[model samples]
Target: MVSKPSSAASARTVSVLALVAAVLVGAFLAPVVYDAAAPTPDRVAVISVDGTITSYTADQLEEDLHEARENESIKAVVLQVDSPGGSAAASEQMYLAVNRTAQEMPVVSSVEGTGASGAYYTMLPSESIYVTPSSVIGSVGVRGSAPIGGSSNEIRTGPDKASMTLDHREAQIETLKHAFVGSVMEHRGDELSLSREEVAYAKVYTGARATQNGYADDIGTLQTAIDRAASEAGLENYEVVEKEPSTRSGIILLSSQNGNSTVVVEESPIGYDGVRAPQFLMVYGQVQYEDEVIGNVSA
Candidate 1:
Protein backbone atom coordinates (compact mmCIF):
# COMPACT_ATOMS: atom_id res chain seq x y z
CA MET A 1 0.00 0.00 0.00
CA VAL A 2 3.11 2.28 0.23
CA SER A 3 5.19 3.71 -2.60
CA LYS A 4 8.74 2.43 -3.11
CA PRO A 5 11.42 4.37 -1.10
CA SER A 6 13.65 6.83 -3.01
CA SER A 7 17.14 5.63 -4.08
CA ALA A 8 18.62 8.67 -2.27
CA ALA A 9 16.89 7.64 1.01
CA SER A 10 18.13 4.07 0.64
CA ALA A 11 21.69 5.33 0.22
CA ARG A 12 21.33 7.43 3.40
CA THR A 13 19.98 4.41 5.27
CA VAL A 14 22.95 2.31 4.15
CA SER A 15 25.37 5.05 5.34
CA VAL A 16 23.64 5.22 8.75
CA LEU A 17 23.89 1.44 9.23
CA ALA A 18 27.55 1.50 8.24
CA LEU A 19 28.25 4.30 10.76
CA VAL A 20 26.51 2.39 13.55
CA ALA A 21 28.44 -0.79 12.80
CA ALA A 22 31.75 1.12 12.83
CA VAL A 23 30.89 2.70 16.17
CA LEU A 24 30.03 -0.68 17.71
CA VAL A 25 33.28 -2.22 16.47
CA GLY A 26 35.35 0.75 17.64
CA ALA A 27 33.79 0.57 21.09
CA PHE A 28 34.81 -3.04 21.42
CA LEU A 29 38.40 -2.52 20.18
CA ALA A 30 39.34 0.79 21.84
CA PRO A 31 40.23 -0.72 25.17
CA VAL A 32 42.27 -3.46 23.56
CA VAL A 33 44.20 -0.97 21.44
CA TYR A 34 44.89 1.19 24.48
CA ASP A 35 46.13 -1.82 26.42
CA ALA A 36 48.47 -2.77 23.61
CA ALA A 37 49.96 0.72 23.58
CA ALA A 38 50.55 0.90 27.35
CA PRO A 39 54.00 0.09 28.73
CA THR A 40 54.61 -2.98 30.88
CA PRO A 41 55.22 -2.23 34.55
CA ASP A 42 58.56 -2.99 36.12
CA ARG A 43 58.55 -6.13 38.23
CA VAL A 44 60.11 -7.07 41.55
CA ALA A 45 60.67 -10.79 41.87
CA VAL A 46 59.94 -12.42 45.23
CA ILE A 47 61.72 -15.77 45.47
CA SER A 48 60.82 -17.98 48.39
CA VAL A 49 63.12 -20.26 50.42
CA ASP A 50 60.63 -22.36 52.29
CA GLY A 51 61.25 -25.50 54.34
CA THR A 52 64.64 -27.22 54.13
CA ILE A 53 67.15 -26.24 51.45
CA THR A 54 67.85 -29.28 49.31
CA SER A 55 69.55 -29.88 45.98
CA TYR A 56 66.16 -29.68 44.31
CA THR A 57 65.21 -26.52 46.15
CA ALA A 58 68.54 -24.96 45.28
CA ASP A 59 68.07 -25.75 41.60
CA GLN A 60 64.58 -24.25 41.59
CA LEU A 61 65.75 -21.09 43.32
CA GLU A 62 68.65 -20.76 40.93
CA GLU A 63 66.22 -20.97 38.05
CA ASP A 64 64.12 -18.20 39.52
CA LEU A 65 67.14 -16.05 40.13
CA HIS A 66 68.34 -16.67 36.63
CA GLU A 67 64.96 -15.66 35.29
CA ALA A 68 65.03 -12.43 37.23
CA ARG A 69 68.48 -11.64 35.90
CA GLU A 70 67.58 -12.35 32.29
CA ASN A 71 64.22 -10.59 32.22
CA GLU A 72 64.60 -6.90 31.51
CA SER A 73 61.25 -6.18 33.15
CA ILE A 74 62.46 -7.46 36.51
CA LYS A 75 64.39 -4.76 38.34
CA ALA A 76 65.02 -6.25 41.73
CA VAL A 77 64.64 -9.35 43.92
CA VAL A 78 63.28 -10.18 47.38
CA LEU A 79 64.37 -13.47 48.89
CA GLN A 80 61.54 -14.64 51.13
CA VAL A 81 62.92 -17.16 53.61
CA ASP A 82 61.07 -19.45 56.02
CA SER A 83 63.43 -22.34 56.55
CA PRO A 84 65.62 -23.88 59.24
CA GLY A 85 68.26 -24.63 56.58
CA GLY A 86 69.49 -27.93 55.08
CA SER A 87 72.29 -29.73 53.23
CA ALA A 88 75.73 -28.09 53.20
CA ALA A 89 76.36 -28.43 49.47
CA ALA A 90 72.85 -27.33 48.62
CA SER A 91 73.05 -24.29 50.86
CA GLU A 92 76.33 -23.29 49.30
CA GLN A 93 74.83 -23.60 45.86
CA MET A 94 71.95 -21.34 46.84
CA TYR A 95 74.36 -18.81 48.30
CA LEU A 96 76.37 -18.71 45.11
CA ALA A 97 73.26 -18.30 42.96
CA VAL A 98 71.95 -15.50 45.13
CA ASN A 99 75.29 -13.78 45.11
CA ARG A 100 75.46 -13.83 41.34
CA THR A 101 71.98 -12.33 41.06
CA ALA A 102 72.82 -9.63 43.60
CA GLN A 103 75.79 -8.56 41.55
CA GLU A 104 73.45 -7.77 38.66
CA MET A 105 70.65 -6.00 40.57
CA PRO A 106 69.47 -5.11 44.05
CA VAL A 107 68.63 -8.11 46.20
CA VAL A 108 66.90 -7.95 49.59
CA SER A 109 65.93 -10.72 52.01
CA SER A 110 62.95 -11.13 54.33
CA VAL A 111 62.83 -13.87 56.91
CA GLU A 112 59.28 -14.94 57.62
CA GLY A 113 59.67 -17.42 60.46
CA THR A 114 63.01 -19.12 60.72
CA GLY A 115 66.22 -18.32 58.81
CA ALA A 116 69.06 -20.08 60.51
CA SER A 117 72.36 -21.77 59.64
CA GLY A 118 72.41 -22.44 55.89
CA ALA A 119 69.46 -20.07 55.47
CA TYR A 120 71.60 -17.30 56.89
CA TYR A 121 74.37 -18.34 54.54
CA THR A 122 72.03 -18.12 51.57
CA MET A 123 71.01 -14.56 52.41
CA LEU A 124 74.54 -13.26 53.05
CA PRO A 125 74.75 -11.62 49.64
CA SER A 126 71.55 -9.61 50.05
CA GLU A 127 71.98 -5.85 50.29
CA SER A 128 69.70 -5.85 53.33
CA ILE A 129 68.11 -8.55 55.44
CA TYR A 130 64.79 -8.08 57.19
CA VAL A 131 63.13 -10.26 59.80
CA THR A 132 59.97 -10.37 61.85
CA PRO A 133 60.28 -9.89 65.58
CA SER A 134 59.68 -13.59 66.20
CA SER A 135 61.88 -14.76 63.36
CA VAL A 136 64.86 -16.94 64.24
CA ILE A 137 68.18 -16.07 62.65
CA GLY A 138 71.81 -17.24 62.74
CA SER A 139 73.21 -20.58 63.98
CA VAL A 140 76.14 -20.23 61.62
CA GLY A 141 78.01 -23.53 61.94
CA VAL A 142 78.19 -27.12 60.76
CA ARG A 143 77.61 -30.58 62.24
CA GLY A 144 77.86 -34.06 60.76
CA SER A 145 77.40 -37.68 61.61
CA ALA A 146 80.36 -39.98 61.16
CA PRO A 147 80.28 -42.33 58.19
CA ILE A 148 78.70 -45.74 58.61
CA GLY A 149 81.31 -48.49 58.84
CA GLY A 150 81.24 -51.68 56.82
CA SER A 151 80.62 -54.98 58.61
CA SER A 152 83.74 -56.85 59.78
CA ASN A 153 82.86 -59.67 57.38
CA GLU A 154 82.43 -57.25 54.46
CA ILE A 155 85.33 -56.94 52.00
CA ARG A 156 86.53 -53.54 50.81
CA THR A 157 88.63 -52.64 47.82
CA GLY A 158 90.24 -49.74 49.58
CA PRO A 159 91.09 -48.71 53.15
CA ASP A 160 88.79 -45.66 52.94
CA LYS A 161 85.94 -47.47 51.21
CA ALA A 162 84.20 -48.80 54.32
CA SER A 163 84.71 -45.75 56.54
CA MET A 164 86.67 -42.55 56.88
CA THR A 165 88.77 -42.19 60.02
CA LEU A 166 87.36 -40.23 62.99
CA ASP A 167 90.15 -37.70 62.71
CA HIS A 168 89.37 -37.21 59.03
CA ARG A 169 85.67 -36.60 59.81
CA GLU A 170 86.53 -34.10 62.55
CA ALA A 171 88.87 -32.27 60.21
CA GLN A 172 86.23 -32.11 57.53
CA ILE A 173 83.66 -30.74 59.97
CA GLU A 174 86.10 -28.09 61.18
CA THR A 175 86.80 -27.06 57.61
CA LEU A 176 83.08 -26.68 56.90
CA LYS A 177 82.47 -24.78 60.11
CA HIS A 178 85.32 -22.41 59.37
CA ALA A 179 84.07 -21.70 55.88
CA PHE A 180 80.56 -20.92 57.14
CA VAL A 181 81.86 -18.60 59.85
CA GLY A 182 84.23 -16.95 57.43
CA SER A 183 81.46 -16.22 54.99
CA VAL A 184 79.39 -14.70 57.76
CA MET A 185 82.30 -12.51 58.74
CA GLU A 186 82.95 -11.48 55.17
CA HIS A 187 79.37 -10.33 54.68
CA ARG A 188 78.42 -9.01 58.14
CA GLY A 189 81.71 -8.30 59.87
CA ASP A 190 81.45 -4.52 59.78
CA GLU A 191 78.04 -4.54 61.45
CA LEU A 192 78.59 -7.40 63.86
CA SER A 193 79.02 -6.66 67.54
CA LEU A 194 79.84 -10.30 68.22
CA SER A 195 83.38 -11.57 67.74
CA ARG A 196 84.52 -14.47 65.60
CA GLU A 197 84.76 -16.72 68.64
CA GLU A 198 81.17 -15.87 69.59
CA VAL A 199 79.98 -16.52 66.05
CA ALA A 200 81.73 -19.85 66.16
CA TYR A 201 79.52 -20.71 69.10
CA ALA A 202 76.67 -21.01 66.60
CA LYS A 203 73.84 -19.47 68.62
CA VAL A 204 70.34 -18.85 67.33
CA TYR A 205 69.31 -15.23 67.76
CA THR A 206 65.81 -13.83 68.09
CA GLY A 207 64.94 -11.29 65.45
CA ALA A 208 65.16 -8.35 67.82
CA ARG A 209 68.46 -9.53 69.19
CA ALA A 210 69.76 -10.30 65.71
CA THR A 211 69.06 -6.78 64.50
CA GLN A 212 70.81 -5.33 67.52
CA ASN A 213 73.76 -7.66 67.03
CA GLY A 214 73.90 -6.97 63.29
CA TYR A 215 72.80 -10.40 62.07
CA ALA A 216 69.72 -8.72 60.52
CA ASP A 217 69.21 -5.20 59.22
CA ASP A 218 65.81 -4.47 60.81
CA ILE A 219 62.52 -5.96 61.92
CA GLY A 220 60.16 -5.92 58.97
CA THR A 221 57.58 -8.05 57.22
CA LEU A 222 57.81 -9.57 53.72
CA GLN A 223 55.84 -6.63 52.31
CA THR A 224 58.34 -4.28 53.85
CA ALA A 225 61.13 -6.15 52.08
CA ILE A 226 59.31 -5.91 48.74
CA ASP A 227 58.87 -2.16 49.16
CA ARG A 228 62.53 -1.81 49.95
CA ALA A 229 63.48 -3.84 46.91
CA ALA A 230 61.31 -1.71 44.67
CA SER A 231 62.74 1.44 46.17
CA GLU A 232 66.23 0.17 45.59
CA ALA A 233 65.43 -0.48 41.95
CA GLY A 234 64.11 3.11 41.61
CA LEU A 235 60.65 1.84 40.74
CA GLU A 236 57.82 4.10 41.86
CA ASN A 237 55.07 1.95 40.37
CA TYR A 238 56.03 -1.68 40.08
CA GLU A 239 54.42 -5.12 40.05
CA VAL A 240 55.50 -7.99 42.28
CA VAL A 241 55.97 -11.49 40.84
CA GLU A 242 56.39 -14.29 43.34
CA LYS A 243 58.21 -17.51 42.44
CA GLU A 244 57.37 -20.40 44.76
CA PRO A 245 59.34 -23.62 45.23
CA SER A 246 58.06 -26.75 43.53
CA THR A 247 55.92 -29.03 45.66
CA ARG A 248 57.12 -32.59 46.24
CA SER A 249 56.48 -35.40 48.70
CA GLY A 250 59.65 -35.31 50.78
CA ILE A 251 60.31 -34.93 54.47
CA ILE A 252 61.45 -31.40 55.24
CA LEU A 253 61.72 -30.75 58.95
CA LEU A 254 59.75 -33.08 61.15
CA SER A 255 59.78 -33.83 64.83
CA SER A 256 61.54 -37.06 65.68
CA GLN A 257 59.59 -39.97 67.10
CA ASN A 258 60.45 -38.79 70.61
CA GLY A 259 58.99 -35.37 69.67
CA ASN A 260 61.92 -33.54 71.27
CA SER A 261 64.31 -33.65 68.34
CA THR A 262 63.97 -32.64 64.68
CA VAL A 263 65.07 -34.47 61.56
CA VAL A 264 65.74 -32.55 58.37
CA VAL A 265 65.30 -34.69 55.32
CA GLU A 266 66.55 -33.26 52.04
CA GLU A 267 64.88 -34.01 48.72
CA SER A 268 68.00 -35.82 47.56
CA PRO A 269 68.48 -39.30 48.91
CA ILE A 270 70.53 -39.07 52.14
CA GLY A 271 73.70 -40.26 50.48
CA TYR A 272 76.04 -40.21 47.53
CA ASP A 273 74.55 -41.95 44.50
CA GLY A 274 71.97 -43.78 46.65
CA VAL A 275 74.49 -45.00 49.17
CA ARG A 276 73.83 -43.87 52.74
CA ALA A 277 76.42 -41.11 53.14
CA PRO A 278 77.39 -38.95 56.06
CA GLN A 279 75.13 -35.92 56.51
CA PHE A 280 76.78 -32.60 57.22
CA LEU A 281 74.21 -30.09 58.31
CA MET A 282 74.20 -26.32 58.70
CA VAL A 283 70.92 -26.41 60.62
CA TYR A 284 69.50 -24.97 63.84
CA GLY A 285 67.40 -27.77 65.37
CA GLN A 286 68.50 -30.78 67.40
CA VAL A 287 69.47 -33.65 65.09
CA GLN A 288 68.82 -37.31 65.71
CA TYR A 289 71.59 -39.74 64.76
CA GLU A 290 71.35 -43.37 63.69
CA ASP A 291 73.55 -46.08 65.17
CA GLU A 292 75.84 -45.58 62.22
CA VAL A 293 76.42 -42.01 63.38
CA ILE A 294 79.64 -42.05 65.40
CA GLY A 295 81.06 -39.45 67.83
CA ASN A 296 79.17 -38.08 70.83
CA VAL A 297 75.60 -39.13 69.96
CA SER A 298 72.76 -37.05 71.40
CA ALA A 299 70.01 -39.55 72.38
Candidate 2:
Protein backbone atom coordinates (compact mmCIF):
# COMPACT_ATOMS: atom_id res chain seq x y z
CA MET A 1 0.00 0.00 0.00
CA VAL A 2 1.21 3.53 -0.91
CA SER A 3 0.42 6.65 1.19
CA LYS A 4 0.32 10.36 0.11
CA PRO A 5 1.13 13.13 2.67
CA SER A 6 -0.82 16.47 3.02
CA SER A 7 1.10 19.77 2.35
CA ALA A 8 0.54 21.04 5.96
CA ALA A 9 1.78 17.73 7.43
CA SER A 10 4.88 17.75 5.23
CA ALA A 11 5.66 21.35 6.34
CA ARG A 12 5.38 20.38 10.08
CA THR A 13 7.71 17.37 9.53
CA VAL A 14 10.35 19.61 7.88
CA SER A 15 10.21 22.11 10.79
CA VAL A 16 10.75 19.31 13.35
CA LEU A 17 13.77 18.00 11.42
CA ALA A 18 15.33 21.49 11.29
CA LEU A 19 14.89 21.86 15.09
CA VAL A 20 16.62 18.55 15.75
CA ALA A 21 19.54 19.46 13.47
CA ALA A 22 20.02 22.79 15.37
CA VAL A 23 20.01 20.98 18.74
CA LEU A 24 22.74 18.56 17.60
CA VAL A 25 24.89 21.38 16.27
CA GLY A 26 24.59 23.30 19.54
CA ALA A 27 25.62 20.27 21.59
CA PHE A 28 28.66 19.55 19.38
CA LEU A 29 29.96 23.21 19.63
CA ALA A 30 29.04 23.85 23.30
CA PRO A 31 32.47 22.93 24.74
CA VAL A 32 34.38 24.96 22.16
CA VAL A 33 32.16 27.99 22.71
CA TYR A 34 32.52 27.82 26.49
CA ASP A 35 36.30 27.36 26.28
CA ALA A 36 36.63 30.48 24.14
CA ALA A 37 34.21 32.67 26.15
CA ALA A 38 34.79 31.80 29.80
CA PRO A 39 37.41 33.76 31.74
CA THR A 40 40.17 31.87 33.61
CA PRO A 41 40.14 32.34 37.37
CA ASP A 42 43.14 34.11 38.91
CA ARG A 43 44.81 32.30 41.80
CA VAL A 44 46.72 35.03 43.60
CA ALA A 45 46.28 38.64 44.68
CA VAL A 46 49.56 40.28 43.63
CA ILE A 47 50.27 43.74 45.04
CA SER A 48 53.16 45.67 43.52
CA VAL A 49 54.90 48.21 45.73
CA ASP A 50 57.30 50.78 44.33
CA GLY A 51 58.82 54.10 45.45
CA THR A 52 58.06 55.70 48.82
CA ILE A 53 55.82 53.85 51.28
CA THR A 54 52.97 56.16 52.28
CA SER A 55 49.67 55.83 54.09
CA TYR A 56 47.99 55.26 50.73
CA THR A 57 50.19 52.27 50.03
CA ALA A 58 49.58 50.96 53.51
CA ASP A 59 45.83 51.37 53.10
CA GLN A 60 45.97 49.52 49.79
CA LEU A 61 47.84 46.61 51.35
CA GLU A 62 45.45 46.43 54.27
CA GLU A 63 42.46 46.44 51.96
CA ASP A 64 43.87 43.66 49.82
CA LEU A 65 44.81 41.61 52.85
CA HIS A 66 41.32 41.92 54.31
CA GLU A 67 39.79 40.95 50.96
CA ALA A 68 41.93 37.85 50.77
CA ARG A 69 40.94 36.91 54.29
CA GLU A 70 37.24 37.26 53.54
CA ASN A 71 37.41 35.40 50.24
CA GLU A 72 37.57 31.67 50.98
CA SER A 73 38.69 30.97 47.42
CA ILE A 74 41.54 33.46 47.60
CA LYS A 75 44.39 31.37 48.97
CA ALA A 76 47.32 33.67 49.45
CA VAL A 77 48.69 37.20 49.14
CA VAL A 78 51.96 38.13 47.39
CA LEU A 79 53.27 41.56 48.31
CA GLN A 80 55.82 42.68 45.75
CA VAL A 81 57.85 45.36 47.54
CA ASP A 82 60.30 47.73 45.83
CA SER A 83 60.71 50.85 47.88
CA PRO A 84 63.53 52.81 49.50
CA GLY A 85 61.69 54.26 52.54
CA GLY A 86 59.10 56.75 53.79
CA SER A 87 57.37 57.98 56.94
CA ALA A 88 57.79 55.74 60.01
CA ALA A 89 54.11 56.06 60.90
CA ALA A 90 52.99 54.88 57.47
CA SER A 91 55.36 51.92 57.55
CA GLU A 92 54.16 50.96 61.00
CA GLN A 93 50.52 50.97 59.90
CA MET A 94 51.34 48.71 56.96
CA TYR A 95 53.37 46.39 59.18
CA LEU A 96 50.51 45.95 61.61
CA ALA A 97 48.07 45.12 58.80
CA VAL A 98 50.40 42.58 57.23
CA ASN A 99 51.02 40.99 60.60
CA ARG A 100 47.33 40.66 61.34
CA THR A 101 46.65 39.17 57.90
CA ALA A 102 49.46 36.64 58.28
CA GLN A 103 47.80 35.37 61.43
CA GLU A 104 44.73 34.38 59.38
CA MET A 105 46.22 33.55 55.97
CA PRO A 106 49.63 33.21 54.34
CA VAL A 107 51.19 36.55 53.45
CA VAL A 108 54.62 36.73 51.78
CA SER A 109 56.74 39.77 51.03
CA SER A 110 58.85 39.80 47.88
CA VAL A 111 61.51 42.44 47.40
CA GLU A 112 61.85 43.15 43.71
CA GLY A 113 64.34 46.02 43.68
CA THR A 114 64.79 47.56 47.09
CA GLY A 115 63.22 47.50 50.55
CA ALA A 116 64.98 49.81 53.00
CA SER A 117 64.10 51.66 56.21
CA GLY A 118 60.28 52.04 56.25
CA ALA A 119 60.02 49.63 53.31
CA TYR A 120 61.83 46.90 55.21
CA TYR A 121 59.81 47.75 58.29
CA THR A 122 56.53 46.99 56.45
CA MET A 123 57.85 43.59 55.37
CA LEU A 124 58.79 42.55 58.90
CA PRO A 125 55.21 41.41 59.70
CA SER A 126 54.95 38.97 56.78
CA GLU A 127 55.16 35.19 57.36
CA SER A 128 58.26 34.91 55.16
CA ILE A 129 60.16 37.49 53.11
CA TYR A 130 61.67 36.75 49.69
CA VAL A 131 64.19 38.95 47.93
CA THR A 132 66.01 38.79 44.62
CA PRO A 133 69.71 38.02 44.82
CA SER A 134 70.50 41.57 43.62
CA SER A 135 67.65 43.23 45.52
CA VAL A 136 68.52 45.65 48.33
CA ILE A 137 66.93 45.45 51.80
CA GLY A 138 67.40 46.02 55.53
CA SER A 139 67.83 49.59 56.60
CA VAL A 140 65.35 48.95 59.46
CA GLY A 141 65.28 52.30 61.23
CA VAL A 142 63.21 55.46 61.76
CA ARG A 143 63.58 59.13 60.80
CA GLY A 144 61.55 62.27 61.51
CA SER A 145 61.70 66.01 61.04
CA ALA A 146 62.01 68.29 64.05
CA PRO A 147 61.34 71.98 64.21
CA ILE A 148 64.71 73.74 64.61
CA GLY A 149 64.79 77.35 65.75
CA GLY A 150 66.21 79.68 63.12
CA SER A 151 66.85 82.94 64.98
CA SER A 152 65.40 84.78 68.02
CA ASN A 153 64.65 87.92 65.99
CA GLU A 154 62.95 85.93 63.26
CA ILE A 155 60.82 83.88 65.65
CA ARG A 156 57.44 85.40 66.46
CA THR A 157 54.23 84.04 67.93
CA GLY A 158 50.92 85.04 69.53
CA PRO A 159 50.84 86.44 73.07
CA ASP A 160 49.43 83.23 74.57
CA LYS A 161 51.72 80.88 72.62
CA ALA A 162 54.72 79.40 74.40
CA SER A 163 58.07 80.15 72.85
CA MET A 164 60.59 77.42 72.03
CA THR A 165 64.24 78.32 72.51
CA LEU A 166 66.94 76.78 70.32
CA ASP A 167 68.87 74.96 73.04
CA HIS A 168 65.78 73.61 74.83
CA ARG A 169 64.17 72.51 71.53
CA GLU A 170 67.37 70.74 70.46
CA ALA A 171 67.45 68.80 73.74
CA GLN A 172 63.79 67.78 73.30
CA ILE A 173 64.46 66.64 69.73
CA GLU A 174 67.37 64.52 70.89
CA THR A 175 65.15 62.90 73.51
CA LEU A 176 62.54 62.06 70.89
CA LYS A 177 65.23 60.58 68.63
CA HIS A 178 66.44 58.35 71.47
CA ALA A 179 62.88 57.20 72.14
CA PHE A 180 62.36 56.31 68.45
CA VAL A 181 65.61 54.37 68.35
CA GLY A 182 64.60 52.47 71.47
CA SER A 183 61.32 51.42 69.85
CA VAL A 184 63.11 50.08 66.76
CA MET A 185 65.45 48.12 68.99
CA GLU A 186 62.52 46.58 70.86
CA HIS A 187 60.81 45.42 67.66
CA ARG A 188 63.91 44.03 65.91
CA GLY A 189 66.05 43.01 68.89
CA ASP A 190 65.00 39.36 68.84
CA GLU A 191 65.29 38.98 65.04
CA LEU A 192 68.64 40.73 64.83
CA SER A 193 70.94 41.97 67.54
CA LEU A 194 70.91 45.64 66.58
CA SER A 195 71.98 48.19 69.15
CA ARG A 196 70.12 51.46 69.59
CA GLU A 197 73.06 53.32 68.08
CA GLU A 198 73.02 51.14 64.95
CA VAL A 199 69.29 51.64 64.36
CA ALA A 200 69.55 55.38 64.97
CA TYR A 201 72.25 55.57 62.29
CA ALA A 202 69.80 54.23 59.60
CA LYS A 203 72.20 52.15 57.53
CA VAL A 204 71.36 50.39 54.20
CA TYR A 205 72.33 46.83 53.28
CA THR A 206 72.11 44.37 50.34
CA GLY A 207 69.82 41.32 50.18
CA ALA A 208 72.62 38.86 50.98
CA ARG A 209 73.68 41.06 53.86
CA ALA A 210 70.04 41.30 55.00
CA THR A 211 69.66 37.48 55.11
CA GLN A 212 72.94 37.18 56.94
CA ASN A 213 71.79 39.79 59.47
CA GLY A 214 68.43 38.00 59.93
CA TYR A 215 66.56 40.80 58.21
CA ALA A 216 65.27 38.80 55.21
CA ASP A 217 64.35 35.11 54.99
CA ASP A 218 65.07 33.79 51.47
CA ILE A 219 66.56 35.18 48.27
CA GLY A 220 64.24 34.46 45.35
CA THR A 221 61.91 36.00 42.76
CA LEU A 222 58.30 37.17 43.16
CA GLN A 223 56.96 33.97 41.61
CA THR A 224 58.79 31.95 44.24
CA ALA A 225 57.23 34.07 46.91
CA ILE A 226 53.73 33.51 45.46
CA ASP A 227 54.31 29.76 45.26
CA ARG A 228 55.52 29.66 48.84
CA ALA A 229 52.54 31.61 50.07
CA ALA A 230 50.15 29.30 48.23
CA SER A 231 51.88 26.24 49.59
CA GLU A 232 51.75 27.61 53.13
CA ALA A 233 48.04 28.40 52.71
CA GLY A 234 47.46 24.79 51.63
CA LEU A 235 45.76 25.86 48.40
CA GLU A 236 46.40 23.86 45.23
CA ASN A 237 43.75 25.46 43.04
CA TYR A 238 42.19 28.74 44.13
CA GLU A 239 40.86 32.04 42.81
CA VAL A 240 42.48 35.46 43.20
CA VAL A 241 40.35 38.42 44.30
CA GLU A 242 41.63 41.96 43.89
CA LYS A 243 39.93 44.63 45.96
CA GLU A 244 39.68 47.88 44.03
CA PRO A 245 40.37 51.20 45.75
CA SER A 246 36.83 52.38 45.02
CA THR A 247 35.37 49.39 46.83
CA ARG A 248 36.98 50.37 50.15
CA SER A 249 34.56 50.92 53.01
CA GLY A 250 35.76 54.18 54.49
CA ILE A 251 35.19 57.63 53.07
CA ILE A 252 38.25 59.60 51.89
CA LEU A 253 37.92 63.36 51.83
CA LEU A 254 40.53 64.80 49.44
CA SER A 255 39.86 68.51 49.44
CA SER A 256 42.43 71.31 49.43
CA GLN A 257 40.16 73.99 50.96
CA ASN A 258 39.06 72.76 54.37
CA GLY A 259 40.18 75.57 56.69
CA ASN A 260 40.31 79.36 57.05
CA SER A 261 43.28 81.78 57.25
CA THR A 262 43.83 85.14 58.98
CA VAL A 263 46.63 87.71 58.90
CA VAL A 264 48.05 89.94 61.72
CA VAL A 265 50.45 92.89 61.81
CA GLU A 266 52.79 94.47 64.40
CA GLU A 267 54.86 97.69 64.63
CA SER A 268 58.43 98.14 65.87
CA PRO A 269 61.03 100.95 66.25
CA ILE A 270 64.09 101.70 64.09
CA GLY A 271 67.37 103.62 64.65
CA TYR A 272 68.33 107.00 63.05
CA ASP A 273 71.79 108.35 62.21
CA GLY A 274 73.09 111.81 63.29
CA VAL A 275 75.99 113.58 61.54
CA ARG A 276 78.38 116.12 63.14
CA ALA A 277 80.34 118.56 60.96
CA PRO A 278 83.57 119.80 62.53
CA GLN A 279 83.33 120.68 66.25
CA PHE A 280 81.01 123.75 66.06
CA LEU A 281 78.20 122.57 63.77
CA MET A 282 75.88 119.52 64.36
CA VAL A 283 73.09 118.37 61.99
CA TYR A 284 70.31 115.73 62.69
CA GLY A 285 67.66 114.42 60.30
CA GLN A 286 64.56 112.16 61.00
CA VAL A 287 62.63 110.17 58.37
CA GLN A 288 58.89 109.43 58.75
CA TYR A 289 57.50 106.07 57.39
CA GLU A 290 54.16 104.33 57.84
CA ASP A 291 53.99 101.21 60.02
CA GLU A 292 52.37 99.34 57.12
CA VAL A 293 55.29 100.30 54.87
CA ILE A 294 57.79 99.02 57.40
CA GLY A 295 55.74 95.84 58.00
CA ASN A 296 55.34 95.18 54.29
CA VAL A 297 59.06 95.79 53.66
CA SER A 298 60.05 93.51 56.59
CA ALA A 299 57.65 90.82 55.56
TM-score of each: 0.80, 0.59
Best by TM-score: 1
lDDT computed for candidate 2: 0.60
Please give the distance, in angstroms, between residue 85's alpha carbon in candidate 2 and its true position after superposition. 1.2
Tens digits of per-residue lDDT, candidate 2, 165-233, equal 545545654664454455445555676655666766666667877676666777888888888888887
Query: How much lDDT does each candidate structure score?
Result: 0.84, 0.60
Q: Tens digits of per-residue lDDT for model 1 on 1-299?
A: 99999999999999999999999999999999999999889999999998766677789898989989999999999999998887888899999999999999999999979999999999999999999888999999987775446457778998767656667878988998999999999999999999999999999999999999999999999999999999999999999998866665533442333322234444435552222345677777864333322222211
Instruction: Quote the positional error of residue 117 for candidate 2 in Å.
Output: 1.0
Weakest 10 consecutive residues, lDDT, candidate 2? 278-287
